[model samples]
Target: MHPVEDHGAPGSGGSRSAAGWLVLLALAGLAAFLLARPILTGPVAGLPAVAQSSSPYTVHRPAGGVRGGGIVNVDTELGYRGTLAAGTGIILDRDGLVLTNNHVIQGATALKATDTRTGRTFPAHVVGYDRSNDVAVIRLSGAKGAGLRPAAFGDSGKVSEGDAVTAKGNAGGKGGAPKIAQGRVTALEQTVIARDDSDGSSERLSGLIETDAAIRPGDSGGPLFNASGEVVGMDTAASAGFKMAKKGKGRGFAIPINRALGIAEQIRQGHGGAKIHIGRTAMLGVQVRPVDAGRTGSGGQSADGGQSGGQGGGQGGGAEVASTLPDTPADRLDVPTGAVITALDGEPVDSPNTLTDLLLRHHPGDRVALTYRMPGGQPVTQQITLASGPPQ
Candidate 1:
C-alpha cells in the first residue's frame, strides 16, 4: 500500500524504493489506515491540512477523451486526510458491473468510476471481494440497465509464451487516455509475493501470466489484450528493479482472466466462502495492536499506556486497543484504550489479523458477544451490534 508518487503525466519513469519492487500497480496516495497503527504522537494542529471538497461525488476528468469498451478510471477517497487514489477496472456487463483488484478499492471510504467508452462517471459500490485472490466485483450505482459495453474475453488457457500482448491502463495514475504498452508474454503460471509497504502485509499470487510490458502504477485491473484484441488477463503487479530478457522493458504480471472471471461470478451470485466476503464488511470500530508481553496488567495501567482499574492479572494473549472511533459500537460500550480484546463471541483473538478474520464472518446488524479485559481486571463480555464498515 505504498502511496504512488504523482508523476502527473503518462510514461514518466521513476525509480522506486526497495519495498516498491515487491508490490506494484497500486493506487497513488493509497493507505490502509485500519490495517496499521495510527500515529498518535502529534497534535491535530501540527498535521498538514488537506482541503475538503464541497461535493464527494464529483470526479476530475483528464483533458483528453479515452476510448475503450467497458474500461474505467476508478477513483477512491481514502479515510485519511481527504486523499484520493486512482486505478483501472474492466466492465463485466451492460449494467455497469466492474471487475478490479481488491487492492485498488481497499480502504476506500467512497468510490466512483469514469467509463472510458461513454465518458460518463457514476458512483459505485462493492458487491463482494476475494481478498486472498486480490479480485473484487463492484456495481455502478443506478446503472442496472445502462447498456454499458463489456470487454471482449479470451481463453487464458489458450495463451502461451511468446504471444504478443498489449497492456492498457491509466499509467502513472494520470487519468487521461489509457496508456498502451506492447510486449510478448515471457512465461506462464508464474508466482510472486506481493507486499504492502504501508502495513508489511503480504499475499502470495500464483498462476500469473508474465510479460515484458511496462505495467505502471494505476494500470492495475486493466486489460491484458491478446493479439486477437481479446482480454487474456488483468494487469496486476510489476517489478521495478528486476531484470528481464528485454533489458529496457519492465517485468509485469497479470492474473489470468479465466480465473478472475470465475471468482467474479462467485461474487455476483452472492456466494461467500473462506476467502471471499460478500457485501459490506462489519465494523467493531476499534484500532488495535499486538499486546506487549513485557507489560503485564499491574498498578491499574493498561497495555496501551492508558489507565484502568481492576483486581485481576492480565490475559497472556489478546489484541490491545489503541483507540476507538466515535459513535462506534466499541465507543458506545466505553471500550477504553489499552484494553485487551481476548475474544469475539467464543473464538480467541490473539492478534489484530485474527480479530479481522473473525469479524469478517459476520455482517452488519449482527449481535455478537465481545470479550475483553481491562488493566488489572477479570474478563468481561458484552453483546454489541455490529455496524456497516468500508470495504476491506
Candidate 2:
C-alpha cells in the first residue's frame, strides 16, 4: 500500500474509475510507488492503486529553492519488501508540529521527515490522525539543531477559482529534492469519494480545492501555495486514466488548509478521544501478507474465494497471518500465524486492506468475529475485541 494514499498491493498495475476522476492515494511507483526501488512484483495490497507512467517524469528544477520554510518531505516504510510512501508536509508550529495527510503516514513502521529549507532529516512521531478527513499531524522528534520554519497560512475561504498557484512535493518518490508544478485553481468545494483499492474503504471528502497544477503521485500531503507563497491547500488525490500504467495528468484535489489545520489542532489537544485516534492508532494486532501463488487450502479454494490476484495477476487475495502482537486481541484469541483470514464479522476478507478497512469501521474495545483457516486446515470463526496502538 502507498500506506496513506492508495491501497493496492505493492507493485500492482491496475486502474479503476470514479466520477470521471479516477481516485488514487497520490502514491508513486506501484513498482516503486513514490519511493523504494522494487524488490518484487504486484500492486501494494492494502494501499490503493493510483496511475503510474512507464516513463519517469521530466524533473523540474526550482530556480531559487524549495520556497517555504515549513514544507517537509515525508518518507514512510510500509513493512513490505522495503516499500515506502513519499509525500509532503507543512510545518504548523516552530515546536516541530507538522501537518500531512493520514494516508501519507498510514501503516508506517517508521517515519523519516526532511525539511526542505534545513536540508536535514529527522525521525518523527505521530501526534494524531483524523481518517475521516484524511489529515494527520506529526512532530519532528529530534531536530533541535535544525531550525523550524512554519509555513504562512492563507484563508482558503478567500481563494477563488482561476487563481494562479504552485504545487510542491516529492514527485515520483524521487529522493533528495522536491518538485514544483504551476497552475491555476480550477474549482472549489469539490467532493471526491476516494477509496483504498486494496480494502475497498472509501471516504467522501467535501469542500476541497481542485486544480490543474500537474500534481502527481507522491505529491499527496504536499502544499498548494498562492502567488504570495502562502499555504492554502494540501494535495491529496489525482485522477487516473482508464488504462493500467496510464499516468495521471495533473487533475488533483486538496483538503483546504484551514480545515486540515483545524482538525490537526484538535488532535494536538487530545480531543475526540478514540473517535479521533491520538498518538497511537487502533489496531487488530495481527501482521499478515498475501497468501502465496498457486497455494490452495481445503476444497481447493483460495482464502480470497478465488485464485490469488485476479486475471491481471496482481497480489489480490486473503491475507495469511504473519504474526500477532503480544497481549492483543489476536494474541488473546491464540490466533496463530499462517492462518488465512477469509472473513471478518461475516464480510469476506479479500485482501489485507479488507481486514484493516473492516477494523477501521469499529472503535476500540468493540468486538468482531473472525473467520480463518489454519494452514492446510478448515475454516474457524472466533470473536475478538479490538486494541489501540501506534502504527508499527
lDDT of 1: 0.67
lDDT of 1 by residue, 110-162 (tens): 88888776678889999998876778999898776665677877777778878
**C-alpha lDDT score of every prediction, in listed order:** 0.67, 0.62
lDDT tens digits, residues 294-391, model 2?
Answer: 66655465443322333221223566676776677787889887787777778777655455555555656777888887765766889877776444
List candidate 1 stretches off by more than 4 Å: 1-68, 144-147, 240-249, 293-314
In the predicted model 1, the residue pairs found to clash are none
Q: Which candidate ranks first by TM-score, i.e. highest?
A: 1
| lDDT for position 325 in model 1 | 72
Error of 1 at 253 (Å): 1.7
